[model samples]
Structures are given as structure tokens and as C-alpha cells.
Target: MFLNHGSFGACPAPVFEAYQRFQRELERQPVEFLALERRLPELLDAARERLAAYVGASPANLAFTTNASSALNAVARSLDLGPGDEVLLGDAEYGGMQILWAYVAERTGATLVHRPFAELAPGPRTRVVFCSHVEWTSGRVNDVAALCRLAREAGALSIVDGAHAPGQIDLDLEALGADVYTGNCHKWLCNLRPSAFLYARPEVQDMIEPLVISWDFHAPSFPERHRWQGTINPCAYLTTPAAIDFQAKHDWPTVRRRCHDLLAAAELGLEPLTDDYVQMRGFRLEHPDPPELKRRLYEEHRIEVPVFESAQGWVLRVSVQGYNDEADLEALRVALAAEL
Candidate 1:
């Protein structure tokens, strides 16, 4: 019945219980559970190890973050941007990131350049090349490896926003070769909310400065520096391993393939924007008013989807997750016919 996995992800019942279990343990013994000298570091390190193996990175170079936006802020804010320096970004970057980068550029006197996501070309003044592995707007997967290579060849840092990638697609961060990468474990991976990671290559780890100068400020490594951010719940981070296990036990690859096929069928007459999408597809909406269509679809017919204006016009994106099926698509179809 739920098709908006991209907007908000849900944890499987087992994973949710695991998250709750961790929370209860923390609540019962705050100091013993959260104190660094005790179980907190061990739990986080184990979680990081599992996640690092899942995403293809070293635990030492990986840091847990609240969300992708916060992770990117840590990187973007730490950079010593100055006048004439450029932060090249994809035109279809997420709206939240657009605001974050705009603030960073405004505060640092750096130029933020927008280029096509698929065919980004870095210039001489480019200091950083930022892009999304899977675009949030169109649900199209960009060639992140190629983009990272291009940024490296340009002598610039490559930063990827992978908020939508983690469990949606298989990842090998080392293979992708980006200077910095951030992804959400809650989405697709189905952990809990606000759980994500930031990856920096060992050589470039020192360049990263924690957004908050906390207890770990004098810690020896990048992960240690960003590991403890003051009394924050570690339940979501600790439950990520269980989320990874849930996918493996359920054979998510097969489920994803099935979802992709269902989405393809749903996109048949929807004027699909591109074939690059897997589980999620964006359709070109000819509706006179996109806002009205969106409201009517959800409020009247109970079809929850994103229909909004973008650079390419009004778009309606349909997501096919393991929980979605042909009936959901059929319901959406019936609703669209009635409304349009």
C-alpha cells in the first residue's frame, strides 16, 4: 500500500525491534551504555565494521552521521573555500543540498557552479565536484565512478551524495574511488531514521573536521573524532547490522528485480523521464496544476506519490519497493484516470 519508499523508508519489524531493544538498554543504563570507556565504543565499532564491509570501506575511515545532509555539511563546511574557488555540482542535486551549498558558498566567497548531472565537466577553478549517486528528483542513477574519476583527473575532490543508494543498490565505495561519500542507512537499508555514514579515504581523512567540536576533538582518527556527538541515541546506528541481515535473509536482490519490473509496467504510459531508474521511476505530468493533482491523489484516492515541478516540468515519481505490488500500481492507475 505504501509506495513512497524514496521519501521515507520503513524498517522491517525485526529490525525495528532490534532498534527498540538497543534503546531500552540505553535508557536503562545511560552512563554504562553511552560512556566511551564502556560498551558504547565497542557497539559502534562493531556496527561500523559490519556497515563498512557492506558498503566497501574501512571502519577507520567511516564515521556515523545523523543524515546525509549533516554528513555533507561536515565536509562542505570544513573545506577552505575562498574567492575564485569553485564547487561544481549537478543541476539536479537535491533541494536541501542546494540550500546547504548555497550557504557554504555565500559564507566562503566560493563559486557554486551547476552542470548537467550526467555530463558534468569540471573547470580549472573547480576545487570540489559534488554530485548524487542516485538523483532524488528523477530517481536516476548517475555514473558516480566516472564522475569520481573525472574529479580526480581535474585535481579536485569528489564528494558524492548517496542518500538513496545504500540498500537500493549494491555499493563498493573503494571501487567508486570518491574522496568523500555519504549514504543513509535508514533508507532502502531500512534501519531506523536519521542513521547514515560518511566515508573518507585514509589519505584524505585529516581534511575532515567534525561539524561539532565534541569530546572526540582530540581523538587520533577521523572516525573517533566524529564518533561521539554528545548523548545522541546510538540505537539506529547499532541496528544497521540487523537491517543488512534482514535484506540478506529476505533475498532483497530478487525483491528489487521484481520491484523494478513492476515499476517498468507502471511507467509504460506515464511518459517516463528515463530508463536509468530501477525501483523508482519519474513520469512527465501533463496535469494543469501539479500541486492540485498531488493533493487529490493522496487525499481523495489515497495514492501517495511525489508530483512536483522540476527543471523538466511537473514530474510524478512512482516507487516500487518490496512492499509494493501490481495492485498498488493499479490503484494509482485508477486514481489518475479519475482525477485527470
Candidate 2:
């Protein structure tokens, strides 16, 4: 039973076929598929248009990256920081991103503050107000739209880490009003691995500097500056439309509701971190070793879920996708009951 779609999503058969089709085409003629501007550029532009429509953003403002981390790093690095500047983030952010901010603060003379979302008050020196739309650790949903309003009031830029938001919740980036936002298509969207997009508001697009000084950097459009970082595969990127179409064709909204109800029915006998979660739920675990519990769930029970220690404590995070059903959650409950 797989219950960890949030960690890395499971792509559907049809979408994976489209992704593979693109890869095979790339191999057929590397120069024409990759190097030719008319071929690769037009294809990427069309893909970006479809994704932008889905996320509620313009094509010129969205840029593709391997994952949300890289997308956020691009935004994090582009910001001009100094000794007195500060970058504020939530205490319950993704672990990898916590390390990312630490690295940035060490390199530049700036302070990184971690506080609860409600307590995030942008001060004079607060250059960036960073947060996650759906927290990775506690599975709590943050009101990032309100956070953006606060940031604007304080004259600070809002950057949202929306890694788990795309398919799990409806997104309207323009209305969400985050100065910068990045989301993972590979997560809730059920796209291929390592597909994500970073959105910078038109007003702030000029503020973001290109991470890679490649051949496409000189393009007049700011978003196009981020294109063609290397010879890295664009097959996953090309399948965005197919991924979106897959969800739409399956009546995903109804499926999501069913999964959410199924997950809610699981009797884990553990305290929930929050009641605001959707298809995924985070439970407080008191096990002596969280990693050991994770290993036992997988090794002994043949169940797949994420059990790790975070600032929040030993967290047992269970995710429910359209593929998940009552049996999967029941198996997890049984396995967890035995361990506890």
C-alpha cells in the first residue's frame, strides 16, 4: 500500500506514456529537438501556456525548473540582501528548504528568522516573506493569500513555496498575489518527476536575475531568460498538458473528495497536528525512533508512508491520492497499531 504521494507523486500510465514519447523523440534527433530554437522553444512555450492557464498566471511570467527547491533557490538567490536584511520563513517549512535558507544566510550578511505563520510580522529589515501554501511537515494549510497582503502592507515581497498545492487545491496565482510563487507539478498534479514552475509577478520579474547565464538569457522576455539551462531532459516538462488533462478527464475533484473522506476515516489513534488538512494528514508520533518506525512500516508491513522527525516532533505523514482507497488506510492503521 502506497500512502506517500506527497514525497514523490505516482504518475498515471497515459501521462507516463506521453513523457516517454517525448524522450524517445529527443533521442531521435538531439540537435533538432534540443538545440533548434524553433523546435524546443516553441514546444516549451506551448507547455508553459497550458501550465500558466492551469495555475492562473501568464505565460511570460512562468519559468520551468527541475523541482520546487530549485525554483525557490532561484528566487532566494536573486534577492539583494545585506547585513541588516532579513528573510522570514515559517518554523514548519520543508526540511530541505530550511537548509537552503541557512546556506543563503551564511553566504550573505543577512538573518533568517523562523516563526509560525500567524506570528510572521514583516519588520523594516524584512526583505522577503517566505512561506509554504501547504506545509510539508504538519500537513497544515497556511493562508498564503493573507500572508501576501501582510507582506505588501509591510513593503516586503511575498514568496510562496507551493510544492504540494497544485493538484491538492485550486490555485489562482494572480489572485493569491504572492510576489513570487513556485509549485511542483510532480506532486499532487501527478506529473512526471522533477517538474515544477516558478512564477514572478510582472513587476518583480526584472528583480529576479537569471541563475544560469546561458544562450537564452539575452532574450527580451524575462521568463525566457530561464529557458535551456543545459542539455537536461525536457520530456517531463513537455507532459504538463497531458498531466493536467489526465486529472480533468478523471473527474479529479470528485476523486479528491473521496480520498479525503477515506483518509479521514482511518483510525490511527494518534493526535492530529491540525484539522485543516485535505487528502493528507499529519499525526504526532511518540515512537522512540521515528526513522525506525518508518523502516518497520515498510520492511515489516509492506506499507509505504513517510515517518520522520521534524521541528514539530516525530511526524507520521500519510498522503491520499485518487489511487488510494479504504484498504490502504486500513492496512496503515493496522500496521501502526501493532507498532505502537
Candidate 3:
């Protein structure tokens, strides 16, 4: 039962069924799917409309990507950074993004500044402040409004990595107002794997080139340059609207509240990292348990969860998505009782 949600994320029966239907249709008419470009504009337009509605952006202002990492890499590499240029970021960001920025900085001579967690203040010479809305290890949601305001005051461009915040909480893109914001539908929205999005305010959109250069090289149009970057599986990208609809159909806000309550009860002895961020709860184990704790959960307990080492401590992270119930959390609680 602990495997019912989170981890790879539990797809609702309807969305999974819809995805299978799309796959069958593609297999049945490969030629037609390939030839969809003449009408691609319309299909993508529909996707944009649904995406914009879900995230509160103008339909014309978003682009699709396989995942959040790809989007972050594109933005990081495209920025015109050189010697003395500094990209400020919180130490708590996802590891993959840190590597991407380091690679870009190596060639361009820009330094990647790891800002102290307490120095959330904005300052001059900070070219880009890349941040995660919620820390992956600790589940501590940042004060984005405060950070963005500081970025604005100091002339730094804000790039938010929102991989865990979107479906876990309500998002108003304009209200967040970062120069670049990227997130994953696959993580919490229950879309198929490799579905994510990048949103840039219209003025800064030109600075982020597509990760793969393709047919839209000469076209000045937004969708032209972004929507059809390459030839690959677009099933996941196209089905995000279905995932969004599935969440609404199930009344997910109520589900999230119930999950939060269950987690609050379970965190009594576990020492949660965040007293405030309640969606993805992280706890410090009381003993130096072997890696077997993670393996045994899957091998014997039929549970799939994540436990990783961080700078502050070892963390057992659990994401409570809509499909999860109190029983799943209870199972983990019982397992901890036995193991630790």
C-alpha cells in the first residue's frame, strides 16, 4: 500500500488509460502522427491554453521540455556570462542543476556562487539567482516573494527551480514573477515521465534558446522556435492537460490536506527537517542504519521511497501525493518502529 503513490508518482486510472490510448493510436497510424506538423500549430495551441490555465500564464509565454533539468540547462548555458559575472544560487538546489551551471561557467569564466542559506538578501553583481521553491532534501519551502523582491532590488535575474512546489501547492506564475521558472508535470501532476515546462516573461524569452535547435531556427514566432524542437516521443508532453484534469476531477486539494495531517501525526519522533513545509516531509533517522533500510522497504515491505545523505544530515523523504492514504504513512511509521 505504501507503493500506491509518490516515488515515480501514481497515475490516475483515467490518465494512464488515456496515455495507452494515445500510444495505440500512434502505433496504428505512425504516418499520421509524423505528419501532424501541418496541423501542429493548432494542437500545440490547445496544449498551451490548458497549460497556461493550469499555471496562470499567458498561453503564448510557455514552452515544453522533457524535464526540468533540460530547461534549466538551456537557460543556464544561454545566459551571456563571462569573467566576473556571478550566478548566485542557494546551496539547497537540486544537484543536477549545480552540475549544469558549473559546466557552463567553466567555458564562460562566470563563477557559480553558492549563497549561504541565511543570506537570502539580494545584492549587486549577482547575475542570476537560481533557486528551488522547495528544497528536495529537507522539504523546506523558501520565501520566494522575498527572494524575488531582493533579486529585483539588486538587478539579479531570478531563475526558480520549482520541481516539487507546483502540484504540491497552488502556483500563480505572475505572482512568483521570476525571470525563468521551470517545473515537472511528471513529479507531482501524475503525467507520464519526462513532461515538464519552462516559463519566461516575454522580455526574457529571447535569451533562452531551445535546448535542441531545429526547424524553427529562422521563425521569429514563440511556438515556432519552441514547440517542435526535435523528433521524439511527444505523448507525455501532450498528455499534461489530461493529468491536470484528472487532479481536478478527484478534488486533490482535499486529498493534500488529509495527507498533510497524516504526515504531521507520523513526524512525532522522526525529527522533521521543516516545521513549516508540510507537503514533502523529511526526517532524520535516530541511528546510523545501513543502506538496507531503504532496500528492505522495497524488498520486504513493498514500499518505494527515497533516503539520501545531505549536508545537514541523512534524510528519509516522503512525497504525499493524492493517491496516497493514511495507511501508507502508517506502514512507513510501523517499518521505522521496527528498523530504527
lDDT of 3 by residue, 201-320 (tens): 888888888888877766686555776676777777778889899889878888778777777777435888886675677778656674778888778887777877776567788877
Off by over 4 Å in 1: none
Off by over 4 Å in 3: 1-7, 116-118
Q: Tell me the deviation in Å of residue 269 in model 1.
A: 3.3
For residues 1-340, what per-residue lDDT tens digits would candidate 2 score against the true structure?
A: 9999999868999999999899899888888988745599888889999999999998888998889988888878887887988999998899998988888898898899989988998998898899989989877888999989999999999999999999999999999999999999999999998799999999998887767777877788866888868678888889999999999999989988998888778899988888888878899999887788899999999999998888888899999999888889999989988999
Question: Tens digit of lDDT per residue, candidate 1, span 245-307?
Answer: 999999999999999999877733578877898787788889788899899888998888888
Each candidate structure's TM-score, on Cα atoms with residue i matched to residue i, is 0.97, 0.98, 0.93
Output the TM-score of candidate 2.
0.98
Q: What is candidate 1's CA lDDT for residue 28?
A: 93
Cα shift from native, residue 34, model 3 (Å): 3.3
**The CA-based lDDT of model 3 is what?**
0.77
